[model samples]
Target chain A: MTENRDSIAEIDLLAYADGRLAGDPVRRAAVERHLARDREAARLVADIEAQNAQIRALYDRVLDAPIPERHRDALWGNAERGGGAWMRLAASVALFALAAAGGAAVGYHARDGIDVPSSLIERAATITPAEAGDATFALASTGRERVAGETVNLSFAMPDLSAFGYRLVARGHPDPGAPNLVRFLYRGVEGKEVSLFMRPRMDPGEERVSTRTVGDVAVSYWSAGPVAVAMRTDDPQMDGIAVAKVLKHAVDFARVSVPGPLDEAAPLDGTGAQMAVEAEAGTMLTDIHAGPSQLQ
Target chain B: MNDDVKWMVERQIPHLRRYALALTRNLDQADDLVQDTLERALKKRHLWRRTGSLRSWLFRILYRTYVDNRRRWRPERMAADPALIDAFASQPPDQEHRVEYTNIAHALDQLPDEQREIVLLTAVEGMAYDEIADVLSIPIGTVRSRLSRGREALRRFRSHTEGAAPLRRVK
Candidate 1:
């Protein structure tokens, strides 16, 4: 305990007071013993620590304040004006989309231990077989949506995966208790199925795309503005990144049609749709492919 | 900038903003200072040596920006808005914390800018002596001396004003 007792210096007092010496117990104990007999040094150390705590208490909360969106825009500057802002935006959205997918996996309550609403799984299991055809019907869960105490009409078109060789064969709310929850069952060749789930998030979150395997089902999820979408497909060979890219673009495009307060609360500026389209058309398109590997 | 670079810069904004606020004391001014810092950092992104940390690089940019711009503005030292402070507090602070906040805010404002910067980087930001030296472009010896003087001055100010109401601007 008295190992470094003689090595304590004026500088060590400050270090000990600021907790820089915390990892070095011998030095810390030496400083403590120095403080035991040296009342003035002890008072100085106490005051220094007190000052640190007070300063931190006064200002640390600024960290919790969401970075002002304009700064986010500024950091990723405007791409069309010759900066890669949209790509940065897309990259960020892709990052969060992946995060939300993980959260959805947990919320979904998947058989591999990623749990979602079991009722949705049950409904997907019990869904009646559709008559044969390549039909793409859009099912929208539209209503006067209330967010943060104000009613706003929120509508975003469900992704059409027809290009991916899948056609919407059925549409309805899988969870009746959650009327806002709508599911579109898409049937591809060989009876392959991809169910797209749509719901309005309670608050607008950053846009992102992430995927998780729910039992045999692969769930690709993304959220933009107030709407969250999860594309669940059981086909192992399915190009999920391509489907997610399509879903993300469709959802971002639909935000252009969502005219009202919802856009105001969105992470992007009022020109979010334009930005989203630019992001889709730009480097982010390529960037999204690189996302799943980096994120997973 | 690349997405990777942009994200790296983006992550450091809050810390930059915190240091800027500590330096300037006014929110709008702090934000403006940080905005300038980010602009400069982006413009000179090539200057950042990958050998060093992004946090230290950003802090270096921020400190230099503060030094370069200090002469252009009139002394408009205002207390952080009480309501802003109230919002920042996790729970409502009692009368004692309010007094403590006022005392330290006043004491901090009174320090020479050099000492104050070192004190804050050391105490508030929890930067090491060498990191402080790197950020300020000073020697480790200078960092220690300035920090010692700064904390001692704060302690002296507190002792002299014990049991007294610290003066606050009425904004």
Candidate 2:
């Protein structure tokens, strides 16, 4: 009889850990009462919770990655049409621009509008990369006292992804709607647009690259040293992490190439920069197994 | 396919892709698996009943597709790296948390395919036992037993590596 009760208790313990017993307050309290006396069962519950967190930490970013272009094309039938598709693409881009520009004000009007667009803008600004689109222009416009006197150039030069068949199309400075954000738009060979929103990193320690999908667009955001960037791309073919590696490698190289005036102005955040470089190298090593090189 | 079904199927793509990636751990293969699943689902759209959960139906198709092509898509599995765990462990408590966060991927990769699928569907996909049973076409009792066994395996794996003694197994 004792063994039978214990067997049922064990199952209840598993159900309790999974919140299966939540709907039944009587059973939940009973399980809680049992857990208070059972140290091993308590530890088991904690382990399950920790394991769940770890599993999510590992794979939840997949939700943020853009759906593969093949899948999107397969479903939407966009890949079937050639010339007509390009016209539609152009129209969509025009529509997006108009909506973004006009909706900038709408974000301020309604608190709920802060979700997709405004939050993207806010996040870009808050994590804005130090260097805007142009390295030279960023240095000069940032003010001589701040740039030459006290701050490292820490310019995040945009990678020339022409190697990957993407060309820079439009660059937007922080407008009234989106403050302290720099937006870079890149057009892919297949008429897909990849937009990168960048801001300065306020926290040096937060360097994990995270991806989020808002509606049809995928946003990959990470901070490296003084600058932070979020690459928002709707191009189904775009691999967010690979492109981030390219950007990180470019920024690391830029840091090495910059002249001494900026170097002496401020002490470099060696740790963050080193971590970024190491991460970039680690990713490059893994890229060997990532199948064909997107870089032609 | 009709627009409504297409829209419903499209909404479930991310969930399907996430599950596929968890199963394969290779991006290219996961995407291929997803592509195949989508194609199969489209072809069989006529059989899908409107009353059933589309998410469960889509998952069932994806799971079946993965099982059918498992051998072809199975990449070389990675063993858990103790040195990596040590590096994370040597840090402060916060870094120890990093060990917990990062090492689980390796541990998960080491789990048996059946256990890994059950664990992922439960933890990552947030599927209920009945739903999981439906998706996998297993009995509800099997779902409960598999989930318990999977969680126990994960707990033991973590506890063993961290040098902590795990509780005695009830089963």
Candidate 3:
């Protein structure tokens, strides 16, 4: 039983039985010798050979047997349906259109009831108000600097509300201290998005807030009454304090709603249609931001 | 519709079905497994960007699906029907003696699922050790070891059965 034990590795014997070791002459010869000397090993080889023969018999007939019509039909059906390629392409186009529309709508709504420059809407979209309630006193400011012959619009949004409410969606459970605080992020011009969020905190009778800068982005936060405010700005050229001041003003405007001489009511042709379009645009933008493009 | 792909699918189905039948030992279950494997391959065709052989990918899906279903069912103690075994054994012996082959099949049914898979893939499917490794996502050494163990077990089972019934071999 042990005559050629050292000469034949079990793995080599298996490989030899499988016919994979046919090209390896040394191992093959060793296994053959071991098989000759050992009855158990020879039986093992015979069993394997028999099993192989039986399997061939079982399946060799299938080569001549007609392929079931169902399988062929399904494959053809898939091919006729464009094999999911066209569907994916259509989804991608729909997603891109949605993202563009969503971005524009969010920019416009965020600009409403504020006296910010129209050119600064793109920058305002990236602004994150520091302190919870600071969003109530918001403003937009833009600084353009020529970078390699291209003018880059650096904009910021300042919200004055120290106490504000927002939702948080994260891959993991949110921290207890950051309850009711949510982060907002937006992809910007350079293929990079700014990250910022707000959490409500209490400070004395009068609600006041503070701001801090993390990496290239600035985070400002405050707690006022029941509201909390936090704004993030990644623009290097714009001052976080200046943006905070504008946000405070916007918050005050949201609270008091003081009517100005230029504040005239405009007639709406179809407010429902406008809202639906805006909603659809938002959905599309969300899809695009979450699609394969972002993953790539 | 690539004619080559169509032709390949048409040709491979019978082989795939036969392999499925051997694995499941039931026609309906085998067809269901084959269908599921094909559906998955079609959905994830992007993963098959001609990196390796298509047959390997298909077999991998089939093997994984079978394993998953087995795990879900957990029919560990279910015994093969003695009547079915006898029926298979009583079939006319080929020139090489069919009784031995039926004993092998019965022994294979008794093997542990992992060992049985190794036997079927290597012996039944005629896959190389490396191909078995790829299909099972195991090291080649593991495949070899499992095959050896499976073969040894089957041989022992056959020898024991033959010793018990000497007259069974006469007819």
Among all candidates shown, the one with the greatest TM-score = 1
Q: Which candidate leads the pack in DockQ?
A: 2
Poorest 10 consecutive residues of model 2 chain B by lDDT?
A: B84-93
RMSD of 3: 27.1
B1-171: candidate 3 lDDT, tens digit per residue: 343344444445665776776677655677788888787777776676444445677888888888888754343331244333333332444644555555656677788878888788775565667767888899987876777777778767877877854322222
Q: CA lDDT of A39 in candidate 2?
A: 81
- Indicate the TM-score of model 3: 0.46
Enumerate the candidates' DockQ scores in order: 0.17, 0.18, 0.12
In Å, residue B70's CA in model 1 sits off its true spot by: 0.6
Q: List residue ranges in candidate 1 displaced over 4 A.
A: A1-7, A79-296, B72-75, B80-84, B87-91, B163-171
> Candidates' TM-scores?
0.51, 0.49, 0.46
Cα error, candidate 2, residue A253 (Å)? 42
Worst ten in a row by lDDT for model 3 chain B: B75-84
* Per-model fnat list: 0.39, 0.31, 0.27
lDDT of 2 by residue, B1-171 (tens): 654346556667877887887787666788999999999988897777543456778889999999999897785563234433332222322455555655576678767888889989987776667878989999988887777777777777767776754433111
